[model samples]
Target: MVIFGVVQIIFSQIPDLHEVWWLSIVAAVMSFSYSSIGLGLGIGKAVEKHADYGSLKGVGIRDVFHDADKTWSVFQALGNIAFAYSFSMVLIEIQDTIKSPPAENKTMKKATTIGVAVTTLFYLSVGCVGYAAFGDNAPGNLLTGFGFYNPFWLVDIANICIVIHLVGAYQVFSQPLFAFVEEWCSSKWRNSNFINKQYTVKLPGYGPLELTLFRLLWRTCFVIFTTLVSMILPFFNDIMGILGALAFFPLTVYFPIQMYIVQHKVKPWSRKWLILHLLSTVCFIVSLAALVGSVAGVVARLQQNYKPFKTTY
Candidate 1:
């Protein structure tokens, strides 16, 4: 965990997401690498002798996982699924950085459509294949939860690729948050040199990079605090579930619908407005359910056996 945080801290120093465009490219490749590897491993497992044949409907609602009600499991699953597609918060930030010969929105729309479609398909394939491989006994995290893959060495490689992919994803998702806080601080403390001053340091393989003492200190602390919390909690899926459920409806569903209504000037109570609002309401319900279920799961885990740093995946 320390090493992961340290690596993130280093990448976080790159100033902004725009400055490290290559990082996303590399991260995308790493994502495909690990995902493809997992898919292949799953296929291999499924074809092997005595392979598990899972139910088409998956685990029942009355089923139990780790002594928790399957209803909560359903909720957690919804949260994770929602989180997988919740990129709206960072989507605008990325679109803002595009170098446009053509229109930026045009590029963004094309990218967004293709990106989302491709990712959704890949995730579905992975989930389906993984479930088929392990059936009802499938682990929460197919990659890490597996006791052993037939070719364990490939698992190690996949793990490395995951770390690399996350290093980029962390910055992609977090840069917006960092930028928001830093900008707010700078505005409030305009006269404070500690917050306003910029220092240019020439580093090899990079141009005269502009940095600030406050940026370094603040970003480092943010990484440290988040890392510590992660280590202490020893919960992965539940935390992701909570974050997903909390952010998905507001950022991805509600705001987008509201924006569309305003941008298109669709009259209130009109067919389009009604449809959009209806979609948003259904999403809100899903998000609420996910949030409640995830929170309950976390509480259950805490009560059962949470060893913090001592807990192993």
Candidate 2:
């Protein structure tokens, strides 16, 4: 994912999304293929009842409530949900990628609806089928649960697809972050050659660099910093939990509704305004709880002296 972030930064430098939209399509297709495969495998396993594998042996809805001390489970689940549905963060940017004025909003709305519906259905099907196949013994990652002994080729294909999809996804999501940082730096260094139009600098080792040193410095540093952090704290679930809790509500729920209310000039005490505010308040509360729970989980894991890349089980 971190490597993908760097790839995203590089691709984001391209001025037009239309030029690179094919990559996104390819990623989407790959994701759909892998997810479908996973669901298919789960269903097949459930039906086959292979002797070595305990297929359908423990098939039932797993108990939801865990020990009180294991609050991390709840938070982790919330994080996963938030992460899955968090595409709202990049919706506006995606919409901007479309050409034209009148139909863009409608098209974007339709696309978003379809995307969400399909993603939700896929997730639900995969989760249910995997649960039916493995019951309480399912691994955190569905792919990981399918060990090397059984149909290893499918696992390999799924993993490869995941890698390809993430490469594109990282670029799609990280572009906005890169743009924001670049804009900020441009504003701060107004006189710099990088921000100035028609300004180029010549270097001894390399021929004329188009932008100033600041651009390369900041962008490279940002990628390096994120990469290092990812390496140091490679707990995917925990990190996803933290990010989702911290970002999902504000980015996905609160800001969009708030912006709409403000744009429409809704009366402060009006029903629409009141309802939106109430919804935002609820999201805020949930976000707070998730943040606290995730933080506690991280601290607990740290206290255990958990090492990255090491399997606990």
Candidate 3:
């Protein structure tokens, strides 16, 4: 995690999301690398070993809490799924990076369609195959779970790909946040040199570049703050579940549907309105359940003597 923070600190200095287009490409490649490896390993295990391993009712209680009933695990699984698909929350920010000979929104829509389809395929394949391979004993983490221990070097490569992918994913999600805060602060303190000033410096081979004292300090502090938070609540999947549950409903579903209704000026009690509201309500219920389950998972972990900075890898 410290290594993650350090890498983030360096890339977070890149100033803008568009500046890290190469990073995005690299991260996407790393994502495919690991996903393919995981999917391939699972397929190999299923074909070579017990081809018929899983039960129809899903795996036993081995995901996080072995003693808890299936309901909590199923609810927590909802949150995990939400987290996996929550990358759409960053789509608007990402869309701003597109080059525009074609209409940007049109391009974004097409790209999003492809991206979602591809990700869904990969995620479902990797997940179902892994479950089939290990049956009731599948670990929460695929590559890092040491489930594919025989191919140590390949597993190692997949893990490394995960690390690289996360490094870029962190910045992809964070740069917009940094921008928001910096823009707000600059506007709030319009004439303050410390807040609004940009400094130009020449790098050894990179030539002149602009820097800001406030950005340097504020972004660094922000990274440190989030790093500390991660260390404190190191329940990776549970934390993801919590964040996913919190962000999924409003960001991913509700707001867009509401905007569409308003833009189209749909009648308040029409079929469209009724359908949209019904969908929103259902999503809200799912999100609420996921949040509760994930929180329970965290509480359960805490009861098992988990401590900050003391958890063994």
Candidate 4:
């Protein structure tokens, strides 16, 4: 989306105000989506799960194979590998970006604050301008959508942006899982394959014939799986949200509460945290129900007919 905006800003013939608006909406949505994965839900639960499972060292090959076996197919296994690699890459990038500056100098603190504030204001301006120009015609994507309705040139620019944005998103999203596998491989291998991974911001290198072989086969499958899905379901944003909500939402909310309950067993807990835990669990349950209910609502909405605003000859 950021890439889309940058390209649109550079190439779109839409009024400056209108271009800004569409870009703003896409940016806001992307920010929220990425943030939610990293902080809002998944990260917390993953930490607790790892701790409970006794870190990577405590797990065995059978455990890995057993888990892998449960995958829907060989393709799904590959998808999981690629997904992990992608997730790790993103996490590492974010960690590096966030960490390097803080450790380097005291001036970074002030600079960071100013940078964030300016970015926020810029996004707000875009949103306001987009709403003013498109009104109800505004779609989630400025270039792809606006071009469809108004000007083909605007969409052409948007398509370019979307391609770049997809690459960036893939680069970031794959980091978390990639880093985990890389670290695990490093522990087992003394070779430069693992060392070379430090330079590139993509998937990390592998070692240990067993682990490397598994990941190679797995990641290959993942690319194919994701490719098929992307082709079949091109509605990326909403689908991503729904998948995130179900898998991530549960993993985030329930796992932590389980950890806390287990950690504090035989001890009385304070009412505040207890209440918070209860509320968290309830929210998850409600969200699950709402998601299920939405399917029916979508079907009903789709089945409804809309009147054409004009007559054709």
Predicted model with the maximum lDDT: 1
Query: Residue-wise lDDT of candidate 3 within 1-313, one digit each (tens)?
Result: 8878987887788788988888889999999999999998888888865455778877555654455647777889899999976777789999988889798999999999999899999989989988887887777887765544688999988989999998888889898898999999988999989888899977776677778999989889989889988888888888889999999999999999999999999999999899999999999999999999899888877877787788742
Write one digit per residue (lDDT tens) for candidate 1, span 1-313. 8999999888788788788789889999999999999888888887888778688777765566554478788899899998986688889998999988799999999999999999998889988888888898877777864546668889988989998998888899889888998999999999988887999988887878888889999999999999998888767889889999999999999888888888989999988888888899999999999999999878888877768788654
Candidate 4 per-residue lDDT, tens place, 189-284, comes to 756553333321222342212224434444445545555555444443334434444553345456556676677672446785678577777756
Candidate with better lDDT, 2 vs 3: 3
Residue 94 of model 3, lDDT score: 91
Write down the RMSD of candidate 1 (Cα, Å): 1.8
Model 4 misplaced regions, further than 4 Å: 1-93, 96-142, 148-154, 179-215, 247-271, 293-313
Candidates sorted by TM-score, descending order?
1, 3, 2, 4
The superposed Cα distance between candidate 3 and the true structure at residue 135, in angstroms, equals 0.9
Highest TM-score scorer: 1
lDDT of each: 0.86, 0.73, 0.86, 0.41
lDDT score for candidate 2 against the true structure:
0.73
C-alpha TM-scores of all predictions: 0.95, 0.82, 0.94, 0.43
Say which prediction, candidate 1 or candidate 2, comes out ahead on lDDT. 1
Candidate 2 lDDT over 115-182, as tens digits, reads 99999999899888777777766666788878753789988999899988877776677667767777
Least well predicted 10-residue stretch by lDDT in candidate 4 = 10-19
